[model samples]
Target chain A: MLKYLFAAFLISICLIVGKALAHYIGFFPGSIYGMLLFAAILASNIFDEAAIGAAIAKIINIMPLVFLPVCVGVIQYGDLLQTSGWKIVAVGMSSTLSVMALVAFICAKILRDERCD
Target chain B: MNAVIEPIIFCICSIAIFFSWLQFHRKFPFALFNPLLLSVISVVLILFLLEIDYSRYMTGGEWISAFIEPGVVALGYPLYKQMHLISRLWRTLIGACCLASLCALTINVLFAKALGIDEWAIRSLATLNITTAIAMETSAEIGGSAALAAVAVMIAGFTGSAFGMLLMSVLKIKNMRAVGLAFGSASHALGAATIARTSMEASAYASTALILCAIVTAIVAPIYIPFLLSL
Candidate 1:
């Protein structure tokens, strides 16, 4: 129980830093940057890997958990979508496909077959 | 109850829904059919049917948010293991990072213009490819709606995953590096997660894309966005 709380404690710190940094430094996604900060500390030897491994695993298990808050709101605002909603969806989805294709094409064309690896 | 538990409940429902989605993700393996998209759709449908105001859902949200920090911290290990690989692919990763953000930015705006979308929605859409945190900032920086962008980016990733798979088939992007980068750019961390399931090498390549894209998006998106608005 204490271990779980410890893991939660660490995550709270990251969120605080992430939220703060997003407001201040205007850098990467705050939570993500906060993660990067945690990453830096871990990688730099400030934190021990084995000690945190089990706790980290529990935390990672719940990482996908955060997407929930936003998903709920999309429902509340459903009526706001309108005719433009589907269009927005179409453009967003199609652009993703095209962007992927365009990127792959550009990379293949730019680099020789041999050096790509 | 309304004042204290609103955020907590909202959060729990969100995590519960996504957890089920990840389970489905195990079987599909196809980028386009990721369970996250379905999960989002399902959540919307349920909320619509049940007529939940979403505010009530927030009551339990804190229950889930407690994990956000540890999750980010845990990722350090993956980044650490793959740090050397990142050093080698620095140039390629950097290039893909730039190209990815620029393309996502341009396409959303230009397409919005052609479609007659509003100004608030325009800036919100700009950060669709970026992760939620940055999307929030991107929305604020461009004088758009963070709430809109946050929703937009999540949906964009879902749609991007679905359509991205189709494009991959058409383009026949058989190479792992290209495949990984394509996934990383269009989907962000979620894209990388899908790639990781495909193969270890593929995951490694995707991680490089993930790290590079995150850093690059951070530096460039905010700077480029305001200028794009000026134009």
Candidate 2:
């Protein structure tokens, strides 16, 4: 659909702007910066969701697919993984669990006033 | 075959496997055969066995990559949709995110350092808690490998989604809010998806946590990581 393509076009424009801004600002990646910008625009109602509804739907459905290239890019770093795969996995897994426990405990402690039924 | 066409072939193969495996994944619902992970493995194995050069494979890889930025930019829509919920829990969510972000970065960095991991790898590890979209970019921005961070993000999401619920029960955390927050803040989309299967409220809360934690990390990591790495 034209709307789908249009939505992708709009996102591409945002991505360019985001990249340019990041180039100058030297902060987070342009992708995230652009996403925030798009979010702000959408929140402001400048771009009605209905106009781009189809695209938004597809984007949400296949977000993981978009990242496949990045994942596959790991093949280029095979040597690194072969040497330190276990360490990366160990560190990654531990930190994830620590975050889960820490956040769960903190949120529960804070929201203890309202109990779930 | 011409050089230009190799990328086209690569693209077709990668996308074919990805979509086909996705269908298989949905029917089977096995974590080990995650569509993304499986596709990557298939591509890697094919490329290795066939003696395909990384440079040529990237022809198609680069094509799909064009969509990645726009795909992430589209995240704004969901964030916008969840704005109401996000605002309602603003105070509590911010606190949890601050703590989560600080702890995620500090613990991962320090643990990796203790193991004497390369500094670049440690930098990539710092983006572990956020979604792959933000993590890959943040990794590169902070002088780490985007590729490595993507893999790390998937690993974090897979592990967290698989065990997060178990951890919550063991800790006696019955609050769905806490449970969802832990899943999203720690695991990203995969964790959010896992919780979504349990309840709507938890899923909503999980998405908010996922988006909020990502934004916080995107903003906080650059300023904080440089300082942390300096030490």
Name the candidate that leads on lDDT.
2
Which portions of model 2 miss their true places by more than 4 Å? A114-117
Q: Which candidate is the best by TM-score?
A: 2
Q: Which lDDT tens digits does candidate 1 get at residues A5-80?
A: 6656666787687778878976555666676777676667765666776877665554555645554455655555
Q: How does model 1 score on DockQ?
A: 0.50
Tell me how much of the true interface, by contacts, candidate 2 captures.
Answer: 0.82
User: How many angstroms is residue B4 displaced in model 2 relative to the true structure, after the best TM-score fit?
Assistant: 2.1
Summarize candidate 2's per-residue lDDT along B101-188 as a digit string, tens digits: 8889888888888888889988887898888888887888888988799888888888987888889989999988889898989998
- What DockQ, between 0 and 1, does each candidate earn? 0.50, 0.74
Model 1, range B1-231, lDDT digits (tens) per residue?
676665655565676778787777667666555554566677667767887766555556546544444454456555666677666766666787789878878788778867888776787777777655456555666677655776677666676555655677688777766777777777766666766766666667666665556556657766776666556
Q: Which candidate is the best by DockQ?
A: 2
Q: What is the DockQ of candidate 2?
A: 0.74
